[model samples]
Target: MTAARAAALPGSEAPAGDERLGEILRALDEDFLAVLGWDWERRVITWPRQHPVIGLPDCPVPGCPLAITVSTRPMCGGCMERWRGSSLPLEEFLLVPKQTSRGTGQGPCVVAGCGRPRVTVAGRLCLAHHVQHTSAGLRVLSLEEFLAHPGVVGHAEFGPCEVAACYLKAVSGQVPYCEAHLNRLYRARTAPGFDEAHWRRTDKAICTTREVSLRGMPERLVAELLYGLWVRTREGFKSRPECLRPVYDRLRARQVQQLEEVTDPAAHGHGREQVTMIRAGSERCAC
Candidate 1:
């Protein structure tokens, strides 16, 4: 190695060749420049750099002013990223589209003295006004009037608590769960083997206990039968009354007997197979 290059090397030990000396020199130069505060190139390579922000995009989150980009969510980067890997569906990022009027979209809101543009082709009112009117049982109100109202346009009194089999109104707390279930959930939050998926699945089954399927039979009696069957089941037992217990028991037996006859595997396998196909066809038909 040359004298200057040799001096740059540690101790008096010399690099065996020019190639080794060149490598050491380049490494030392990089270190020297990094100490002198010219390390941006290295930093850029090591860490990702955000692209320059372009036009303004409002966050979909209420009361948040963050500009949106990168993710598909209308919310800002922070809110959108917070929901990453969450149970909430991505489709919920787009709230319901506002109704708007047709044509060039140049006119002011249909409500007098309102200046906001229409959001739908069918409605003349701005989205806010339209929602207020529709949600308030079609009562017309000016922007100021709607704002001055004591209650939220869509809020109803004594709405059912989120928990199943809990008849109490929802507590006006940060959590949507009823007072009892809120405590239950809070206590379970740190419990071992507590699964949110299991809780949700159970809750869904409970909430749909009363929902009747209207397909095929096209009669109110069919709805009654379905409701009766659900009420007699273990999941719906909490809501069933003692007076109707015998009635439900008889109904359940009759229903099971009828279902068996309709669905039974016959002496010939073809009979059961034909019944299965018929059942599938009936389920698929809109009627």
Candidate 2:
């Protein structure tokens, strides 16, 4: 019989021809959409031509009876709940823009421990809280500002000449002690007679002197003076038996070199006299 006659016959299987049924079945198996509603004789799967409300033509979510396509997926509420209970399906979820209310456009603040609207980076917390907590906690004050405060000058929290001196030096941005003193402390700490009590005494003295002098000086000047003194004292002490003579000599040489670098003749002239005075003083003092 002819291939067309066999295909048209009711309840009769089509005769094997050049286009084998097995080949057609294999092609249908390869296509997912073709399996939906495929007809062997017709050689076509019926698919909805128009775009469905949901991207998927048919959703396999369980317990969904409605045929209407959903905005995201056609799954009914029941199917969505079931899917969510197991694992989240990518197809079932949709991204939507965040909504805003009309009253006040300001959204909730993201910063922790803050109820106020976030404005600046530092102002994550409310202005009042930020000022009260951070500003007060740090005791933020410039050198001049701190020195000008009566409490800082004579506060019980900062006492003793040595401690006061160190604090002042730190505040004024000066070296706290003569270089000799710094060397002495460094040597003492590393020496055989090193003791906590001795350290405390020495430290106290240095701080007290620095604090007193720093009260009226600029931070930079105070720091430089204290540092110079500390270096001289420290090195002098470290050099033991050599005494201040050698230390003074070294310092003088350094000072002279520095003076030479100054283009101004007057400034250069002043250091020579100071160097002489320092050397004279060192000669009289015992290490």
The per-model lDDT (C-alpha) reads: 0.37, 0.31
> For every model shown, what is its TM-score relative to the native structure?
0.20, 0.16
lDDT of 2 by residue, 1-287 (tens): 23443345333343345233323222222233222233333221122323221122333443222222333544543445555775655454422211221111122223343334322222222333334334663358653454344443221111111322222111111333333344555666777767745343324222110011222222222222223333333344211111222322333223322212323334233344433433333332222
Backbone-clash count (model 2): 32
Clashes of each: 7, 32
Q: Which stretches of candidate 1 lie over 4 Å from their true place?
A: 1-160, 164-168, 203-287
Instruction: Give the clashing residue pairs of candidate 1, or none.
Output: 99-119, 99-120, 100-119, 100-120, 100-121, 101-120, 101-121
Error of 1 at 29 (Å): 90
Give the per-residue lDDT of model 1 (tens digit) for 1-287.
23464355344333355442243233333332222222221110110112221123455655443445433455655566555755667666445232221221122345555544444334455555666667845477665665556553333223444543233344433555444455667776687888754442233111111111121221222223332222223122222122222222322323332222453433234334333433343332222
Q: Scored by Cα lDDT, where does model 2 land?
A: 0.31
Error of 1 at 134 (Å): 38
What is the lDDT for 285 in model 2? 28
